[model samples]
Target: MTAEKANNLLEQIARSKKEGRLPPVHDWHPPFCGDIDMVIKADGSWHYMGSPIGRERMVRLFSTVLRRDDDDYFLVTPVEKVGITVEDVPFVVTAVQVRDVEGAQVLEFTTSVGDTVVASAENPMRVELDPQTQEPRPYILIRDRLEARIHRNVFYELVEMAKPTLIDGVEWFGVESAGEFFRIAPVS
Candidate 1:
Protein backbone atom coordinates (compact mmCIF):
# COMPACT_ATOMS: atom_id res chain seq x y z
CA MET A 1 0.00 0.00 0.00
CA THR A 2 1.07 3.52 -0.73
CA ALA A 3 2.17 5.75 2.15
CA GLU A 4 -0.60 8.22 1.37
CA LYS A 5 -3.29 5.54 1.58
CA ALA A 6 -1.76 4.24 4.79
CA ASN A 7 -1.96 7.73 6.26
CA ASN A 8 -5.57 7.90 5.15
CA LEU A 9 -6.29 4.65 6.92
CA LEU A 10 -4.67 5.98 10.08
CA GLU A 11 -6.70 9.18 9.87
CA GLN A 12 -9.89 7.20 9.45
CA ILE A 13 -9.07 5.02 12.44
CA ALA A 14 -8.08 8.03 14.53
CA ARG A 15 -11.34 9.80 13.72
CA SER A 16 -13.35 6.73 14.61
CA LYS A 17 -11.54 6.35 17.93
CA LYS A 18 -12.19 10.01 18.77
CA GLU A 19 -15.88 9.65 17.92
CA GLY A 20 -16.20 6.66 20.20
CA ARG A 21 -13.93 4.71 22.54
CA LEU A 22 -12.68 2.35 19.84
CA PRO A 23 -12.49 2.12 16.10
CA PRO A 24 -15.65 0.83 14.44
CA VAL A 25 -13.68 -1.82 12.56
CA HIS A 26 -15.98 -4.55 13.81
CA ASP A 27 -18.96 -2.79 12.28
CA TRP A 28 -17.21 -2.21 8.97
CA HIS A 29 -17.67 -4.62 6.09
CA PRO A 30 -15.12 -3.21 3.71
CA PRO A 31 -13.88 -5.35 0.83
CA PHE A 32 -10.44 -6.91 1.18
CA CYS A 33 -7.89 -4.72 -0.54
CA GLY A 34 -5.29 -7.49 -0.75
CA ASP A 35 -2.25 -7.98 1.51
CA ILE A 36 0.09 -5.44 3.02
CA ASP A 37 3.75 -5.89 3.93
CA MET A 38 3.06 -5.63 7.60
CA VAL A 39 3.81 -8.08 10.36
CA ILE A 40 3.06 -8.30 14.08
CA LYS A 41 5.83 -10.34 15.63
CA ALA A 42 5.42 -12.73 18.50
CA ASP A 43 7.58 -10.43 20.61
CA GLY A 44 4.93 -7.71 20.22
CA SER A 45 6.80 -5.69 17.63
CA TRP A 46 5.28 -4.18 14.54
CA HIS A 47 7.02 -4.11 11.18
CA TYR A 48 6.05 -2.73 7.79
CA MET A 49 7.83 -3.25 4.51
CA GLY A 50 10.52 -5.20 6.38
CA SER A 51 11.25 -2.26 8.69
CA PRO A 52 10.35 -1.92 12.33
CA ILE A 53 7.50 0.44 13.19
CA GLY A 54 9.47 2.47 15.75
CA ARG A 55 6.77 4.94 16.72
CA GLU A 56 4.76 3.60 19.63
CA ARG A 57 1.86 5.91 18.85
CA MET A 58 1.65 4.78 15.23
CA VAL A 59 1.71 1.13 16.25
CA ARG A 60 -1.08 1.77 18.74
CA LEU A 61 -3.08 3.56 16.07
CA PHE A 62 -2.75 0.61 13.69
CA SER A 63 -3.74 -1.74 16.46
CA THR A 64 -7.04 0.09 16.83
CA VAL A 65 -7.96 -0.77 13.24
CA LEU A 66 -6.85 -4.36 13.59
CA ARG A 67 -9.54 -7.00 13.24
CA ARG A 68 -9.70 -10.74 13.03
CA ASP A 69 -12.17 -12.79 10.96
CA ASP A 70 -12.13 -16.48 11.67
CA ASP A 71 -8.35 -17.22 11.65
CA ASP A 72 -7.12 -14.33 9.50
CA TYR A 73 -6.04 -10.89 10.72
CA PHE A 74 -6.78 -7.71 8.87
CA LEU A 75 -6.62 -3.96 9.12
CA VAL A 76 -10.01 -2.55 8.28
CA THR A 77 -11.63 0.79 7.73
CA PRO A 78 -14.99 1.87 6.41
CA VAL A 79 -13.81 1.63 2.81
CA GLU A 80 -10.95 -0.88 2.90
CA LYS A 81 -9.63 -4.02 4.48
CA VAL A 82 -6.10 -5.40 4.10
CA GLY A 83 -4.39 -8.47 5.42
CA ILE A 84 -1.35 -8.55 7.73
CA THR A 85 0.77 -11.37 9.10
CA VAL A 86 0.71 -12.25 12.75
CA GLU A 87 3.51 -14.44 14.11
CA ASP A 88 1.75 -15.75 17.17
CA VAL A 89 -0.90 -13.67 18.93
CA PRO A 90 -1.48 -10.01 18.09
CA PHE A 91 -0.72 -8.50 21.49
CA VAL A 92 1.68 -9.27 24.33
CA VAL A 93 0.93 -8.67 27.98
CA THR A 94 3.67 -6.38 29.16
CA ALA A 95 2.57 -5.70 32.72
CA VAL A 96 0.16 -7.00 35.31
CA GLN A 97 -1.28 -5.34 38.40
CA VAL A 98 -3.05 -6.85 41.35
CA ARG A 99 -5.80 -5.14 43.29
CA ASP A 100 -8.62 -6.11 45.57
CA VAL A 101 -12.11 -5.60 44.28
CA GLU A 102 -14.80 -6.24 46.87
CA GLY A 103 -12.51 -8.66 48.70
CA ALA A 104 -11.50 -10.48 45.54
CA GLN A 105 -8.00 -10.17 44.17
CA VAL A 106 -8.25 -8.80 40.66
CA LEU A 107 -5.62 -9.16 37.98
CA GLU A 108 -5.34 -6.33 35.54
CA PHE A 109 -3.16 -6.90 32.47
CA THR A 110 -1.64 -4.28 30.24
CA THR A 111 -0.85 -5.14 26.66
CA SER A 112 1.81 -3.74 24.35
CA VAL A 113 -0.78 -1.68 22.52
CA GLY A 114 -1.89 0.13 25.70
CA ASP A 115 -5.04 -1.94 26.30
CA THR A 116 -5.88 -2.69 29.89
CA VAL A 117 -8.07 -5.69 30.68
CA VAL A 118 -9.16 -7.27 33.89
CA ALA A 119 -9.08 -11.03 33.99
CA SER A 120 -12.53 -12.29 34.78
CA ALA A 121 -15.18 -14.69 33.51
CA GLU A 122 -15.51 -12.48 30.47
CA ASN A 123 -11.75 -12.37 29.87
CA PRO A 124 -10.29 -15.54 31.27
CA MET A 125 -6.67 -16.67 31.37
CA ARG A 126 -5.19 -19.93 30.15
CA VAL A 127 -1.87 -21.68 29.70
CA GLU A 128 -0.69 -24.04 26.98
CA LEU A 129 2.36 -26.14 27.64
CA ASP A 130 4.70 -26.98 24.83
CA PRO A 131 4.81 -30.69 24.11
CA GLN A 132 8.53 -30.98 23.52
CA THR A 133 9.97 -28.42 25.90
CA GLN A 134 7.08 -28.12 28.36
CA GLU A 135 7.33 -24.37 28.02
CA PRO A 136 4.38 -22.37 29.20
CA ARG A 137 2.44 -20.34 26.68
CA PRO A 138 0.12 -18.26 28.79
CA TYR A 139 -2.51 -15.90 27.49
CA ILE A 140 -5.30 -13.60 28.56
CA LEU A 141 -8.20 -12.45 26.48
CA ILE A 142 -8.20 -8.82 25.41
CA ARG A 143 -11.30 -8.28 23.27
CA ASP A 144 -13.32 -9.66 20.35
CA ARG A 145 -11.40 -12.93 19.95
CA LEU A 146 -8.11 -11.09 20.44
CA GLU A 147 -5.70 -12.23 23.16
CA ALA A 148 -2.31 -11.22 24.50
CA ARG A 149 0.41 -13.70 25.31
CA ILE A 150 1.50 -13.04 28.86
CA HIS A 151 5.09 -11.85 28.96
CA ARG A 152 7.73 -13.94 30.73
CA ASN A 153 8.23 -11.59 33.64
CA VAL A 154 4.49 -11.11 34.10
CA PHE A 155 3.92 -14.84 33.98
CA TYR A 156 6.52 -15.35 36.65
CA GLU A 157 4.75 -12.80 38.81
CA LEU A 158 1.50 -14.68 38.32
CA VAL A 159 3.13 -17.94 39.33
CA GLU A 160 4.44 -16.36 42.49
CA MET A 161 0.84 -15.49 43.41
CA ALA A 162 -0.70 -18.82 42.43
CA LYS A 163 -2.60 -21.00 44.84
CA PRO A 164 -3.98 -24.49 44.71
CA THR A 165 -7.61 -25.04 43.81
CA LEU A 166 -9.60 -28.23 43.50
CA ILE A 167 -10.98 -29.03 40.09
CA ASP A 168 -12.32 -32.39 38.92
CA GLY A 169 -11.09 -33.92 42.20
CA VAL A 170 -7.54 -32.87 41.36
CA GLU A 171 -5.46 -30.03 42.75
CA TRP A 172 -4.44 -27.40 40.26
CA PHE A 173 -2.38 -24.24 40.67
CA GLY A 174 -4.29 -21.15 39.67
CA VAL A 175 -4.97 -17.52 40.45
CA GLU A 176 -8.05 -15.58 41.43
CA SER A 177 -9.18 -12.42 39.70
CA ALA A 178 -12.54 -10.69 39.71
CA GLY A 179 -14.06 -13.52 41.74
CA GLU A 180 -13.03 -16.01 39.06
CA PHE A 181 -10.50 -18.82 39.45
CA PHE A 182 -8.24 -19.49 36.46
CA ARG A 183 -6.09 -22.57 36.35
CA ILE A 184 -2.49 -22.00 35.41
CA ALA A 185 -1.31 -25.58 35.66
CA PRO A 186 -2.44 -28.95 36.89
CA VAL A 187 -0.44 -30.22 39.83
CA SER A 188 1.60 -33.24 38.92
Candidate 2:
Protein backbone atom coordinates (compact mmCIF):
# COMPACT_ATOMS: atom_id res chain seq x y z
CA MET A 1 0.00 0.00 0.00
CA THR A 2 1.22 3.47 -0.86
CA ALA A 3 1.80 6.08 1.85
CA GLU A 4 -1.05 8.26 0.57
CA LYS A 5 -3.50 5.37 0.65
CA ALA A 6 -2.35 4.23 4.07
CA ASN A 7 -2.77 7.74 5.40
CA ASN A 8 -6.31 7.96 4.07
CA LEU A 9 -7.17 4.66 5.73
CA LEU A 10 -5.75 5.86 9.00
CA GLU A 11 -7.77 9.02 8.72
CA GLN A 12 -10.89 6.95 8.28
CA ILE A 13 -10.07 5.04 11.42
CA ALA A 14 -9.60 8.30 13.28
CA ARG A 15 -13.00 9.46 12.16
CA SER A 16 -14.56 6.16 13.14
CA LYS A 17 -12.99 6.34 16.57
CA LYS A 18 -14.43 9.80 17.01
CA GLU A 19 -17.87 8.72 15.80
CA GLY A 20 -17.89 5.73 18.19
CA ARG A 21 -17.79 3.12 15.47
CA LEU A 22 -16.06 -0.21 15.96
CA PRO A 23 -12.67 -0.54 14.32
CA PRO A 24 -12.90 -2.63 11.16
CA VAL A 25 -11.45 -6.15 11.09
CA HIS A 26 -9.51 -7.25 8.04
CA ASP A 27 -11.63 -9.67 6.07
CA TRP A 28 -9.31 -11.93 4.07
CA HIS A 29 -9.76 -11.76 0.35
CA PRO A 30 -9.17 -14.57 -2.08
CA PRO A 31 -5.60 -15.94 -2.55
CA PHE A 32 -4.86 -15.31 1.13
CA CYS A 33 -6.69 -17.87 3.34
CA GLY A 34 -10.00 -19.14 4.57
CA ASP A 35 -10.20 -18.06 8.24
CA ILE A 36 -10.96 -14.50 9.37
CA ASP A 37 -8.69 -12.09 11.26
CA MET A 38 -8.88 -11.67 15.05
CA VAL A 39 -9.14 -8.71 17.40
CA ILE A 40 -7.42 -7.90 20.73
CA LYS A 41 -9.11 -6.67 23.89
CA ALA A 42 -8.13 -4.25 26.67
CA ASP A 43 -7.17 -7.19 28.87
CA GLY A 44 -4.81 -8.52 26.18
CA SER A 45 -7.03 -11.44 25.31
CA TRP A 46 -8.14 -12.38 21.78
CA HIS A 47 -11.66 -12.57 20.34
CA TYR A 48 -11.66 -14.98 17.39
CA MET A 49 -14.10 -13.50 14.89
CA GLY A 50 -16.44 -12.76 17.79
CA SER A 51 -15.67 -16.02 19.63
CA PRO A 52 -13.41 -15.71 22.66
CA ILE A 53 -10.93 -18.45 23.47
CA GLY A 54 -8.63 -18.97 26.44
CA ARG A 55 -5.02 -17.87 26.19
CA GLU A 56 -3.54 -21.39 26.02
CA ARG A 57 -5.28 -22.57 22.85
CA MET A 58 -4.83 -19.12 21.44
CA VAL A 59 -1.05 -19.55 21.67
CA ARG A 60 -1.27 -22.99 20.10
CA LEU A 61 -3.21 -21.53 17.15
CA PHE A 62 0.23 -20.97 15.63
CA SER A 63 2.53 -23.72 14.43
CA THR A 64 6.08 -23.17 15.62
CA VAL A 65 8.22 -22.51 12.56
CA LEU A 66 11.23 -21.20 14.48
CA ARG A 67 11.83 -19.04 17.50
CA ARG A 68 12.25 -15.34 16.93
CA ASP A 69 13.34 -12.65 19.37
CA ASP A 70 11.79 -12.15 22.79
CA ASP A 71 9.48 -9.45 21.52
CA ASP A 72 8.21 -11.66 18.70
CA TYR A 73 8.14 -15.41 19.08
CA PHE A 74 8.02 -16.33 15.40
CA LEU A 75 5.49 -18.99 14.50
CA VAL A 76 3.24 -20.00 11.60
CA THR A 77 -0.51 -20.08 11.87
CA PRO A 78 -2.10 -23.51 12.17
CA VAL A 79 -4.82 -22.29 9.82
CA GLU A 80 -4.88 -19.97 6.83
CA LYS A 81 -3.76 -16.46 7.66
CA VAL A 82 -5.87 -13.86 5.87
CA GLY A 83 -5.56 -10.46 4.30
CA ILE A 84 -7.68 -7.97 6.26
CA THR A 85 -9.46 -5.09 4.57
CA VAL A 86 -10.28 -1.98 6.56
CA GLU A 87 -12.08 1.04 5.10
CA ASP A 88 -11.37 -0.61 1.72
CA VAL A 89 -7.60 -0.70 2.45
CA PRO A 90 -6.15 -4.18 2.82
CA PHE A 91 -3.41 -5.59 5.09
CA VAL A 92 -2.39 -9.12 5.96
CA VAL A 93 -2.69 -10.36 9.55
CA THR A 94 -2.53 -13.69 11.39
CA ALA A 95 -4.31 -14.50 14.64
CA VAL A 96 -2.11 -15.37 17.63
CA GLN A 97 -2.64 -16.06 21.37
CA VAL A 98 0.09 -16.28 24.00
CA ARG A 99 -0.04 -17.08 27.71
CA ASP A 100 2.38 -16.60 30.61
CA VAL A 101 2.05 -20.29 31.58
CA GLU A 102 2.65 -19.33 35.21
CA GLY A 103 0.15 -16.45 35.06
CA ALA A 104 -3.38 -16.04 33.73
CA GLN A 105 -2.49 -12.93 31.76
CA VAL A 106 -2.07 -13.40 28.00
CA LEU A 107 -0.66 -11.55 25.00
CA GLU A 108 -2.41 -11.55 21.66
CA PHE A 109 -1.01 -10.50 18.29
CA THR A 110 -3.03 -10.05 15.14
CA THR A 111 0.06 -9.99 12.90
CA SER A 112 0.25 -8.96 9.27
CA VAL A 113 -0.68 -11.90 7.08
CA GLY A 114 2.11 -13.00 4.79
CA ASP A 115 4.45 -15.92 4.09
CA THR A 116 7.60 -13.83 4.26
CA VAL A 117 9.41 -15.31 7.23
CA VAL A 118 11.37 -12.82 9.30
CA ALA A 119 12.42 -12.20 12.88
CA SER A 120 10.29 -9.96 15.09
CA ALA A 121 12.08 -6.62 15.48
CA GLU A 122 10.11 -4.43 17.81
CA ASN A 123 6.76 -5.45 16.32
CA PRO A 124 7.05 -7.28 13.03
CA MET A 125 3.53 -6.22 12.04
CA ARG A 126 0.71 -3.91 13.01
CA VAL A 127 -2.40 -5.00 14.93
CA GLU A 128 -5.80 -3.42 14.34
CA LEU A 129 -8.85 -3.47 16.59
CA ASP A 130 -12.47 -3.63 15.48
CA PRO A 131 -12.50 0.19 15.38
CA GLN A 132 -14.38 0.43 18.72
CA THR A 133 -11.63 -0.84 21.06
CA GLN A 134 -9.01 0.94 18.98
CA GLU A 135 -10.52 4.19 20.20
CA PRO A 136 -10.45 3.34 23.93
CA ARG A 137 -7.57 0.81 24.03
CA PRO A 138 -4.92 2.99 22.50
CA TYR A 139 -2.00 1.64 24.48
CA ILE A 140 -0.65 -1.51 22.85
CA LEU A 141 0.96 -4.23 24.93
CA ILE A 142 4.19 -5.07 23.10
CA ARG A 143 6.21 -6.67 25.84
CA ASP A 144 4.48 -9.20 28.11
CA ARG A 145 5.30 -12.25 30.21
CA LEU A 146 5.12 -14.67 27.25
CA GLU A 147 7.28 -12.41 25.10
CA ALA A 148 9.80 -12.01 27.93
CA ARG A 149 10.15 -15.77 28.20
CA ILE A 150 10.59 -16.17 24.43
CA HIS A 151 13.32 -13.57 24.44
CA ARG A 152 15.06 -15.27 27.32
CA ASN A 153 14.74 -18.81 25.96
CA VAL A 154 15.02 -18.22 22.21
CA PHE A 155 16.06 -14.73 21.18
CA TYR A 156 17.89 -12.87 23.95
CA GLU A 157 18.08 -12.91 27.74
CA LEU A 158 16.51 -10.37 30.08
CA VAL A 159 17.30 -10.20 33.77
CA GLU A 160 14.73 -8.73 36.15
CA MET A 161 14.93 -8.28 39.89
CA ALA A 162 12.34 -10.07 41.99
CA LYS A 163 11.46 -6.69 43.45
CA PRO A 164 12.05 -3.22 42.04
CA THR A 165 12.67 -0.39 44.44
CA LEU A 166 10.74 2.64 43.33
CA ILE A 167 11.71 6.28 43.62
CA ASP A 168 9.47 7.86 46.23
CA GLY A 169 7.14 10.66 45.07
CA VAL A 170 7.16 9.45 41.48
CA GLU A 171 3.57 9.55 40.27
CA TRP A 172 3.69 6.38 38.18
CA PHE A 173 5.66 4.24 35.80
CA GLY A 174 4.85 1.27 33.59
CA VAL A 175 4.04 -2.02 35.24
CA GLU A 176 7.05 -4.00 36.46
CA SER A 177 5.41 -7.34 35.77
CA ALA A 178 2.05 -8.73 34.62
CA GLY A 179 0.77 -10.31 37.84
CA GLU A 180 1.93 -7.35 39.90
CA PHE A 181 -0.12 -4.71 38.10
CA PHE A 182 -3.77 -3.79 37.49
CA ARG A 183 -5.32 -3.34 34.06
CA ILE A 184 -7.78 -0.67 35.14
CA ALA A 185 -6.04 2.09 37.01
CA PRO A 186 -7.84 3.97 39.79
CA VAL A 187 -9.18 7.40 38.96
CA SER A 188 -7.81 10.00 41.36
Give a tens-digit lDDT track for model 2, residues 50-106: 655465532332211212232332222222233321221112223334445465443
User: How much lDDT does candidate 2 score?
Assistant: 0.30
RMSD of each: 1.0, 16.7
| Predicted structure 1: lDDT | 0.93
Report residue 177 deviation for candidate 1 (angstroms). 0.6
The TM-score that candidate 1 achieves is 0.97
After best superposition, candidate 1 residue 149: deviation in angstroms? 0.3
The C-alpha lDDT values of all candidates are: 0.93, 0.30
Q: How high is the lDDT of residue 49 in model 2?
A: 52
> Each model's TM-score, in the order given?
0.97, 0.23
Residue lDDT tens for model 1, 5-49: 888888888887786577767899989899999999999999999
